[model samples]
Target: MAENKSTSARAASAASSKTEADIQAQIDQLRGDIANLTKLIGDLGSEKASQARARAEKLRDDATKAGQEAYDRARDEALSMEEDLEDRIRMKPLQSILIAAGVGFLAALFTRR
Candidate 1:
C-alpha cells in the first residue's frame, strides 16, 4: 500500500508542473501579441498623417494657381480699359478737358456741403 501511494503522489506532482508551464507559456504569448498590435496601430496612424499632409499641400498649390489666373485676367481687362480711354482723350482733347472740369466742379460743390 505504501508503494502505491508514493507512485500516485509523484504522478500528481508531475501533472501539476506541466500545467503551470503551459499557463506560463500562454501568458508570454499573449504579451507578445499585445506588443505587436500596439506597433501596428502606431504605424497606421503615421501613414494616415502622411496622407493628410500630402492632400493639404495639393489643395494649397491648386488655390495659388487659381488666384494667379484671376489676377492675370483682371490686369488684362484693366489695361484694355486704360488704352480705350487714352485713345478717346486723344481724339478730342478739348472735349475731354471740358468734361474733366465739369466733374471737378461737381466734386468741389459736393465737398463744400
Candidate 2:
C-alpha cells in the first residue's frame, strides 16, 4: 500500500510539472505573436500615412489643373465676345454714323431754324 501511494504521488507530480511547462511555452509563444502584431500595425500605420499624403498631393494638383482650365475657358469666352462685338460694330458702322449725323442735324435745325 505504501509503495502504491508513492508511485501515484510521483505520477501526479510529473503530470503537474508537464502542465506548467506547457503553460509557460504557450505564454512565450503569445508574447512573440504580440510583438509581431505590434510591428505589423506600426507598418500599416506608416503606409496609411504615406497614402494619405499622396492623395492630398494628387488632390491639390487636380484642383490646380481644374482652376487653370476654368480660367482659360473664361478668358477664351471673353475674347470671343469681344471679337463678336467688334465684328458687329464694324458691319454696321455706316448705319450708325448716318443715324448719329441725322440726330445732330435735326437738333441743329430745331435750334437755329
Candidate 3:
C-alpha cells in the first residue's frame, strides 16, 4: 500500500511538472507572437504612410498641372480678347476713343462718393 501511494504521488508530481512546463512554453510562444504582431502592425503603418505620401504627391502634381493648364487657357483667352480689342480700335479709332472717354467719366462719377 505504501509503495502504491508513493508511485501515485510520483505520477502526480510528473504530471504537475509537465503542466508547468507546458504553461511556460505557451507563455513564451505568446510573447513571441505578440512581438511578431507588434512588428507587423508597425510595418503596416509604415506602408500606409508611404502610400498616403505617394497619393498626396500625386494629387499635388495633378492640381499643379490643372492650375497651369487653366492659367495657360486664361492667358490665351486674354491675348485673343486683347487682339480683338486692338483690331476693333484700329478699325474705329474715334469710336474707341469716345467709348474710353465715356467709361472713364462713368468711373469718375462712381468713385467721387
Candidate 3, pairs of clashing residues: none
lDDT of each: 0.99, 0.97, 1.00
Better of 2 and 3 by lDDT: 3
Report model 1's TM-score to 2 decimal places.
Answer: 0.86
Off by over 4 Å in 3: none
lDDT of residue 15 for candidate 3:
100
Q: Best by TM-score, which number? A: 1
Q: Per-residue alpha-carbon lDDT of model 3 for 1-113, expressed as tens digits?
A: 99999999999999999999999999999999999999999999999999999999999999999999999999999999999999999999999999999999999999999
Best-first order by TM-score:
1, 3, 2
lDDT of 1 at 78: 100
Consecutive 10-residue window with the lowest summed lDDT within model 3: 104-113
Give the total clashing residue pairs for model 1: 0
Question: How do all models score by TM-score?
Answer: 0.86, 0.57, 0.82
* Backbone clashes in model 3: 0
Tell me the tens digit of each residue's lDDT in model 2 across 18-106: 99999999999999999999999999999999999999999999999999999999999999999997797799998878888999999
Q: How close is each model in CA RMSD to the real structure?
A: 1.7, 8.2, 1.9
Best candidate according to lDDT? 3
- Return the lDDT, model 1, position 106: 100
